[model samples]
Target: MTQELSPCIRTVNVMRYVTPLREGGSMPAIVEADDDFMYVVKFRGAGQGIKALIAELIGGEIARALGLKIPEIVFANLDASLGRTEPDEEIQDLLKASVGLNLAVHYLSRAITYDPTVTTIEPLLASKVVWLDCLLTNVDRTARNTNMLMWNKELWLIDHGACLYFHHNWTNWEEQSKRPFVQVKDHVLLPQASELAAVDALFKPILTEERIRAIVGLVPSEWLTFNVENETAEERREVYIQFLLTRIANSAIFLNEAQHARQSLI
Candidate 1:
């Protein structure tokens, strides 16, 4: 949460707006954050608000917590006044034409999708991305499709808001019971895990208790849920945080390494 939320800090010189994503891109204004920034604007779309946005920011942060590379979240001023060129018109109408600060994301192309089994010099990077997905309990990266971005053969991971065991809640009990410990492990990540063991090393210092708490705290409460029905926002957030923490703690053998790293810093 060390990120600054200043309105005048920077202006996103939106490049060509990407067409609304068929799957999950429709709601947000996925425009480049600024001329120098690589990420794009992620606005509150149709169902835009606390619960839905909470799913996005928090879910993405959780992925980063588990040693995955993800786009950084930046708060930006996206009022109707700031205009360069419509990145993609289809997604434009879906946006609130109002001028105001919106949740903007850093663009990550390497984390974009790529064809699996494609030859590359840094195939190990691909393995790391997959392993990161597993640690997050991400079931989205199945054989059906993988999200990746390639640069110099290095692969990046993206779009995990629907992951972290979400499908478990929506699936039938019998099917859910058949799920793997970490769905990513069920794929080809395990056999090639050693190839990217070093990637785990990078996360050790970043996953400390304090660091994790800050991230969990930075998650805007409204994003967690809209009508708590019975509980307050704080109560719901604590409950959600506790659940996420349990999942992170049980994810993998390397988790201890990240934990120990966090402890030493404390």
Candidate 2:
């Protein structure tokens, strides 16, 4: 039960909407912030809504906690009037809807999508990535959509809004926490990830409860109102914490699932 320092993400004001990535349903866009840096902003008004933002923040931080490479995440402030002059009606509508705080990651220029066919990842690193996705129950890291970028010859994880699927249906979170991530079979790196057990041992202690609680604490209070009846920010945060802690404790389940999946690939 060691305590690690909790990392705090900075808040930035969106100065200009640069362009839309338009890759996912969320319509994440590249925008210029007050700091004069570019970020890929995930709009709260997008189809996935704030839960996606929460997943991005928590999941990205967790990846960073495990010593993985992830772009810096920031709280991007969007003014209500920022989109008034935009010519496109749809972009204008999205901007107007997301006129408060949004989640954004620093824009990595010239980074190419990870092509597993061309570049190879070391076994331990591949195992670590697979392990992280399993812990978060992320379903988007398959071969069809790797959700990884190769920047300066290093792999960077991104787009974790699809993680933490249990939050989408809160009725069975406790049960879901202990379940193995069966989707590991589709994971892009599973075949290369031969060191899951070693990675499990090395990473488990690094993500102490204190660190996890701190990571969950990053979710803004506004995003937790998805369930107006019972899920307050405090309660929702607790759910994330408990789910992750339980999943981490039951890591053997997913580790075995991933190992079996790899064996099938052989």
**Candidate topping TM-score:** 2
Where does the lowest 10-residue lDDT sum fall in candidate 2?
1-10
- What lDDT score is found at residue 104 in candidate 1? 61
TM-score of each: 0.62, 0.97
CA lDDT, every prediction?
0.50, 0.92
Error of 1 at 58 (Å): 3.3
Per-residue lDDT of candidate 1, residues 21-87 (tens digit): 5555335545654455655555554543434445556656655555455566665655554343455
**Model 2 regions lying over 4 Å from their true place:** 1-4
Indicate the TM-score of model 2.
0.97
lDDT of 2 by residue, 123-160 (tens): 99999999999999999998889999999999999999
**Which residue window of length 10 is worst by lDDT in model 1?**
1-10
